[model samples]
Target: MDILSDLWLGAQTAFSVWNLLYCLLGVFLGTAIGVLPGLGPTATIAMLLPVTFGLPPETALIMLAGIFYGAQYGGSTTAILVNLPGESSSVVTALDGYQMARNGQAGTALATAAIGSFAAGTVATVLIAFFAPALSAVALTFGPHEYFSLMVLGLVASIVLASGSLLHAVGMVLFGLILGLIGTDINSGEMRFTFGRFELADGISFVIVAMGVFGLGEILSNLENEQGRSVTLSKVTGLMPTRADLKRMVAPVTRGTLIGSVLGILPGGGAMLASFAAYALEKKSSKTPERFGKGAIEGVAAPEAANNAGAQTSFIPMLTLGIPSNPVMALMIGALIMQGIQPGPSVIEEQPVLFWGLIVSMWVGNLMLLVLNLPLIGLWVKMISIPYGFLFPAIVAFCAIGVYSLNNATFDIWLMAGFGFAGYLLRKLDCEPAPLLLGFVLGPMLEEHLRRSMLVSRGDATTFFTRPISAILLLLAVLLIVSILAPAVRQKREEAFTDED
Candidate 1:
């Protein structure tokens, strides 16, 4: 009963004409960015973040959250129509979705992806509304020691979750951690890795690294690939799924929603991991696994569902725990901190309207995505015909502009370009960038908590293992390392793991 009243209060706050307009604007812009290849939510949000400075904090957060999830809905449109995934999480959609497109079932693929995403997003939003308070309570008990250990567990989970060689994933994480350590030390005011450069004092900008790796790197990769014209079918076909397709999708959607909603709460579990894990789970559960890559509807349905669910639920940790599970959430954290709102248990107690209004707005934004996307599929498909030369240069421009906007520094622009070249080389070498991004985001927070715990314990590192929660978390991290290194476990892991799908 109390929950209902609070939700009503939230709706009242979110229902204002101005707030509604911003919600629509956010979803509209999000869908646009999602349709265009290489402009992901992170890049789009980073670029627009400065503009939100004038809005009230609640309104800004509501709009930003809408854009974040709306990208998940729009990313699949590009994947199915052009075999170009706008977001990493949409990569699996390319496998079966493009196959369906090649076979002239593009309309069906697009429709199903949209519907599945809507369904998953709706369910996850409802779950978040009810579960967030309870989850925040669990998070409130965590001290610096516990938070530090949780981050360690998160890093381990990320390494395990990353597709590719375990050693390579660890190496990427370590590199990210090292990169994160480049700025002035928090405890001691001395710079560690500045190397006599004044610009290095502020550390590597997250926007620069994200834009360079995701936005610029994607542009370069797309430019390298020869353009292929859309293969149209001779006859028009139905867009709606058949009875058999619906039956298969039902189970996958249900399982995916459940899996994604749960995993998305954990640090490092976002849309990309949700999609990957969903594909793996679906494969494991399928009676005929051979159908997975060859126009399998379940392949399209599951990951789309999972990624959307994960996208919605990924807000949980950021909003409730003040811990960002991914780069996108990290940016959200920065936004909230800028607003002078400390995101954690007290956020809800102090600002219930903001909290619940954001949840209610998610449902509204998702409905908008479904209605807006279905009729616009043809338009989005037409966008794929735009020439790469015309398209990629714009992306490059945005990357440069966004990086420079961080500090309005041309040096940062040069730094971004340097990283772009480095990212291009790394991509060529088959090394992944996502884990590195994760490590970079987590490393500073991990260090902060570690130092705080040590100070409380008078410089005893053993304090990490002395606290119960921290002890358990550290043990789990150690166990994960040992399991990955065990010869027999290594063989099984190698067989089970596949490259980014």
Candidate 2:
């Protein structure tokens, strides 16, 4: 009842004419970015960070949060129509969604994704409202050792769940960690991996790397393939799935929502892990697993739901503990910091209106996505008819402009182009980029926590293993390692990642 009253108060704040307008603007821009094939929430948000400086904190946050979730909703449109995923979370969607489009079931595929997302998002929001406070209390008890172990688990899970060879994924993670170490040492103020370059002394901008690796890299990879055609959105008949389709999807959606909610609360799992895990679980449990890559509706629904749910729940850690689970959340934290608002346990109590207002706005944002997505999907489908040759060049140009816009520096454009080419080579070698992103985000934080934990323990490493939460997390990490080493599990994992024949 208290939660409901708080939510009502929040709605009052979020539904104001001005606030709603910002929400709409964010969603509108987010959809545009998602449809553009390579741009994502990260790049889009990073680009707009400067503009929000003048807005009130709640309004700024509402807009940014709207973009984050709105992009998730819109990302599926391209994944279904063009086999292009705007976000890593949408990668699994591309597998079955693009197949469904080719098979003339684009409408059904998209409808399932949108509806499932709406359902899961609604449920997750309620869960978050009730659970976040409790979870925040739990988080308050965590010491530096516990936090360090959690970070380690997060890094391990990211590497293990990445979509490529185990060794390759680990290598990519290490590379990202190295990239993360490029800035001056925060504790010592000593230059580390700047390589004596003035521009690098501040470390590579998150915007630069995200734009280069995902945005420009996608364009360069597209250029490597001369097959330049998207599935035509000529015939979309069904807007609703049949009872039979619904029956098949029910279990997957339920399981996915559960899995995503739990994993999303864990630092580093976020939307990408949730979506991938949901798909993997669906495949494992399916009677006709072979149907997955060839346009299984469950594949579309389960992962879409899980990803959105994960994206929502990921906010819990950031809101409660002041720890960002992913880069997007990190950006949010940055936004909050800019406003002189520290995200921690006290936030909900100290600023009830802001906290509740944000929660209410999420519900509003979800509703807007459903209303907007259902109608706009057809428009998105039509974009498939655009020629890939023309599209790739535009994508390349967009990447250059977006990356350069950060500091108005041409250096970023060149850097992105270099990384884009490098990304192409990595993809050719069957390496995964998702783990790299996770590692880059977590590496510095991990080092800081590790050092802090060690100092608190008087330089004794045993503290990490002795703490109950830390011990459990370490055990889970060990289990993950053992599972990867297990011959049977290894074989299945290998087969799962190998492109469906």
Candidate 3:
């Protein structure tokens, strides 16, 4: 079959010595940075994008792909160990993972995360190979109305990730949307809220906000609470899960991979949304729902699996439709364009080696990550056991360095420090950063699609309902919000994200 031939060609290209070495290097760097607070694949790839210009397109992409999935693997490590999610998608992982760490089950949580990620990555790779073109077609069918409706669904779903007051969550999402408006307007060619500072011209960097909130913010919270610091330094007991833990994780992993693979095909809905939705679903379905925000292994397993699977399958839109599914895939698209390669359906036939080899490399990278991470589980858990006095300084330093690297400006570093203080205040207010970050990330895209839909429809607001897919998505979002208002559902929703008083 032509597919078999394509696979064989991809294997030959991906397994070459140089490609394999680059793949290993990419994943290694990805894991190292991913273990650090607030440095994610998007920033790392953006920084290295210049260096890759000199390399072959295939080799460069293969390496970048490795970094992406590798970071997904490593993000779970920090989420489990320190209650800091190095990657945005790992936010929910910290809910249960950090509790597990405090309860002396860090090793088990980390192991479960790793195993679930590997399984998901492996499955997503095959799905990409078999269904990329078909999925791309489905994605292309989504017009601006559909996209706006989809993002509406995403924003409403963001509330599910919050355990605090639903009102606070809505407020944070609105706040994030406002922050996202600080940059120049796309259509009017006018600045919204730059405040006469050119630094605000591009608005705030996500790196600055996330690192400050999750990385620096977390550091401040811990320093102020001496008891939390001691609990964070708990001993690492079992390095592996009991048989029951393994059995319980199986269903969640399977469900997460399925959810992730489907969601990943949506251009604006990649790993972050996939992980959030997966965790929401898992908690909703669990028999002992109260265990979720505590130390539930299912929480760790499902989100990890969803994130990795989403990370892999996100390429479907980028590779086949010339649309980026996330920031990393956008960077991947830039790399392809720089190499004089145009993305879209033609690329598969015209640049078979690049397309298929990149696909093959994903599976290769997953294998490398599994091999790289499994043995170091013990070492990773132990590193956090260092005295908080010594540990926090290093985290703050890394956060500053990572934020500065984003645009090579000292201003972002200061911005991050400011947000750090704000994060601590929010912690005191009992709010989670996840919903705010989610809103910030999705806000611009949502607005863009909404405006486009209106423009295309000649200012007709009925377009969203007139379109079937858009209508269905909006209905679902509405239904979800209505259901959350019910007494029984509202109580459960609150329980899912927040601890009971």
Candidate 4:
């Protein structure tokens, strides 16, 4: 009853004319960006973050949240139409979605994806409304030791789950941590890694780093293969799914929503992981696994549902615990900071309107996406044919403008360029940048919590172990690391025996 009342208040706030307009604008822009290949939600949000600076905190947050989940709705469009995944989470969608298009069921695939996304988004929103407050109440009891241990677990999970060699992920995390150390020491009031540059005293802008790595680096990568690429927009037929199609999709959609909702709440887990896991689960559980990559509607339905559900639920950790599950959530944290709102357990209680309104807005945004995607499918298909030559330059321009707009500092622009080059090089080396971004975001908080915990315990390292919560978190971190490495060791041993044979 209390929850319903709060949600009613939230619905009232979210339905206001200004909030509704911003929400509509956000989803519209998000769908546009998601239709284009290689321009993901992270880059789009980072670049457009400045646009939210002037708005009220609630409105800004509402708009940003809309964009985050709206991308999930739009990403499946490209995956089905041109076989290009606009978002990483849509990669699994492309496998079967593109096949569906090739089989002349493009409209059915798109319709299924949109409907599944809406269903999952609605369920996830309700879950957040119910669970976030409970999570916040639990998090309110955490001390510095527990927080530090939680961060350690989060970072470890990020590295372990990142798609690449374990060693490379570790190296990237270390590199990001080093980069994070550039600013002045918060406790000692002394410069640590600034190297005498006064600009360094304030620390490197996270916006710059995000835009460089995700925005510019992606542009550079796309340009490399731009010449050889061609898009064939499949004609969408049968906009409505048949009764049998709906029956086949219902079970997978339900399973995917459940899988995504659970995973999205975990540290360092988000849409990408959820989508991949959902597809794998669907394939494994299907009576005919061989049909998975051959225009299977279940494959299209499951991952699309999982992706949208995860995208919405991933906000749970960031909102309730101030822990970003992925880079997009990290950017949301950055947005919160920009609005002078400290993201943590207190956010829900302290600013009930903002928190609840944001939650309600998510449901509204999902509804808008369902209404908007179908009519705009043709426009999105045409967008897929735009040449890279025109697209990359515009992206570069937006990134530069967005970074420079942060503090109006030319140095930040240069710094972004340097990081852009670094990001490109890192990509060329097959190292994933996602873990690096997580490390960079978590580094300072981890350091602050570690120092505070040590001070409380007078430098006794055992304090972390003595605290029940901290100890459990640390144990989980250790288990996660071992889980990742043990398989590699066994594989290496097997390879050695095969070589000998």
Candidate 5:
């Protein structure tokens, strides 16, 4: 009854004409950008963030949420049709999907991916509606000590992410922390890293950082490594799967949904992790494992299901615990802050409309993708043929315009350009910008909690160890660090990420 009431409340907000239209536009643009290779959700969302500034918080968030999962749906289209994954999460989908295409089963693979993704998204939506509230209730009790420990655990856990090079990830996080420290000190009211510029008093805006690093940085990187796309199937006919194909999809979809839901809740876990893990699981569990990369329908179905489920469920931490599971969620935290809404346990109680509305809109957006994507596959395939040279100028112009609109200041634009160049250099060095973004987003919160905990304990450092929940969280962080350092475990982690594709 409570959930039913909550859903009703959410539906009211999500189903408004303007809200529905925003959601549609988001999914449509998300699919279009996703269909084009090399544009991931983080960059797409970052690029489009300025467009959402005029809308209400709930509507803006609903639209952004649509773009995220819509990208997941659209990615499979590229993988199956062009043998080029549109998003990183769709990389595994390309393995069997492309093989199926070559064997004249392109339509069948696309159908399987769509259906599995719909099933997984449907289930994951309900799971979030049910699970997020409980998680938030638990988080409501977290004190400064517990919160500080949790942030430490998050930073440590992120170091072990499938992102390349543990040392590079750690260094990026520290770099982000240093950047986050540039602002004035909240407690002491002293300038920390202003460097004699009055403009630096408020520190760098997260918006500028995100736009430069993900938006401009992505475009720069893509231009650097741009390649021609070879389409395997320009014309697809059969959009329906056979009954046997449906049967094969069922079990894998179910298992993937479950795996994705669980992993989606973990620190640093997102759609990317769930898809890779799901593909690996199906491979390891298959009776004829050799068929995985050779047009196996289950290979297409399982990861498709998992990525959608993971993409949906990854909202749990951001909505409830105020911790981001991925870079996109980190940006969502910034979005909430810009909306004057803090992302934490109190969000549910203070802004039920924003919370429940977002959850409900995901299902609506998923349904829209399922209905619209299959019929538009041809259009998406055609989009891949368009040269990147045509799109680059638009992206660059938009980045400059968006940053300027933030505060109507040209300085932010210049700052974004600098970060874009820096991000490009870092990528060349094999350093992932994800951990750095996470660190930038969480650093201030971590410092605030640490200072609060210290203040509460009269500057006693042992207070974190004395609190039961805090101690357990810190211990888990320690174990994670220790495990990553062990040579055997480290090797295994590397192997897991070393996919054949």
Candidate 6:
């Protein structure tokens, strides 16, 4: 079928009453939670996965996708109003957004963010509809050797792009790979890391780990600074930007959308990186670079647009190549698995309703967010004032309930608590949880592909290098590792010279 026909069918499905309701509900919940500091779409979706068990696959997926991008809109609200970024992607937004709020332009900043996000999301959705099929066709040619090499490149890129010490990130990835080994081995049927527990034979639940690490752990971390959260609730004035403001923002938003659209398609690149890159680009290209971080409208508009665009396009790899670009996409992969669907090239061909419906729903969800956030701006402003004393307990309660609901097992709850403590410790050590989650998500696939490749090559280790695609991918992986270490090496050399001087 042609793309137009497929999209038409998708529109029919996405516009159905039930699907529309799910879309609305997802955006509503997403925006609400995103306005709250210390909560993000990852934790929110992880905590709510159990609720979707009874839902149809398309409905559940639509809602989940809604939360992912809807949070982009809501995150900027908190960033502007409270100077607290609700998600990592909003960190750049808070720089100029809070400054705008301090200058009594909170309403303008919020409106700019809302409008820029809407524009970026609309364009990104169209890009997905156009490019996903072509990408899927390319992905169909991948063999086991190529798949394994691609995964290797992805993992290395994730580690290199992640913030903090390279050593620490590597350690976290290894730890996650170890954790992913805690189940029966598919080849030998041997219990690898179950520790003599039958309940663990199937493997550790992704939801439990995600909720503990991101949801509960974030709550604990927030509690540490809860007493010091002094939000500056600047009164919002002027709900619309001036003509000059629009004129200034137009170029930045467009540039940001383009940058985000490209980066979002790369392995291990997502909203966080896209926002940072867009903000940097804006600052570098600005005639008045000194005006940045001091309420520059471009600062707010660029990152906001980039983040939303990145969020939308990041779905492409997961849908078309079965390769998750980030932790959130990994969670979506898990969700697809739960629905008895394997994510890959064939998904679009075999499940056109699911594919097209999700694409159309993203556009619908973006509209819902635009409508929902603009009218409810005042409500979100008040929500920022909610005390952590009242908030953390409710979050803890919801997390516990969600974990238990996964299997009606108290053991899972205990397991979640254990991981929560581990997560806190990891945070204290300044280790990023995102890479760990990605590693954990890809571990099984990595192992599967490795085994298949090895078997096909009759244990010949040269197979990865013999195949052109696999060789190129492995070369890229090596280059990424070298590039990451080169910076640190250069820094050390500079320090040594300074010491000698």
> Which candidate comes out best when scored by lDDT?
5
In candidate 1, position 416 carries an lDDT of 78
Q: 1 or 4, which is superior by lDDT?
A: 4
lDDT of 2 by residue, 28-55 (tens): 7777666655557875675566567688
Residue 324 C-alpha lDDT in model 3: 59
lDDT of 2 at 449: 84
TM-score, cand. 1: 0.87
TM-score of each: 0.87, 0.81, 0.67, 0.95, 0.98, 0.95
Model 2: lDDT to the true structure:
0.79
Instruction: Measure candidate 1: CA RMSD.
Output: 3.3
Q: Which is the better candidate, 3 or 5, if ranked by lDDT?
A: 5
lDDT of 4 by residue, 113-230 (tens): 9989999999999999999999999999999999999889888988867665677788988888888888888988898788789988978878888888888888888778563334
lDDT of 5 by residue, 322-401 (tens): 99888988988888988889999999999999999998888899889889988988789889988999998998998899
Cα lDDT for residue 243, candidate 5: 89
Worst 10 residues of 5 by lDDT: 492-501
- Model 1 local distance difference test score: 0.80
lDDT comparing candidate 6 with the true structure: 0.88
Report the C-alpha lDDT of model 1 over 364-389, residue by residue, as the tens digit. 88888888877766666666566668
Residue 272 accuracy (lDDT) in model 4: 84
Per-residue alpha-carbon lDDT of candidate 3 for residues 9-45, written as tens digits (9 for 90 to 100): 9999999999999999998878766765444676567
User: lDDT of each prediction vs. the true structure?
Assistant: 0.80, 0.79, 0.79, 0.87, 0.89, 0.88
Superposed by TM-score, candidate 1 places the C-alpha of residue 103 at a distance from the truth, in angstroms, of 6.0
Q: Residue 402: error of model 5 in Å? A: 0.4
TM-score of 6: 0.95
Which segments of candidate 4 are over 4 A away from where they belong? 227-235, 488-501
**Candidate 6 lDDT by residue in tens digits, 431-461:** 8788888888888889999999999999999
User: Which segments of model 6 are wrong by more than 4 Å?
Assistant: 227-235, 488-501
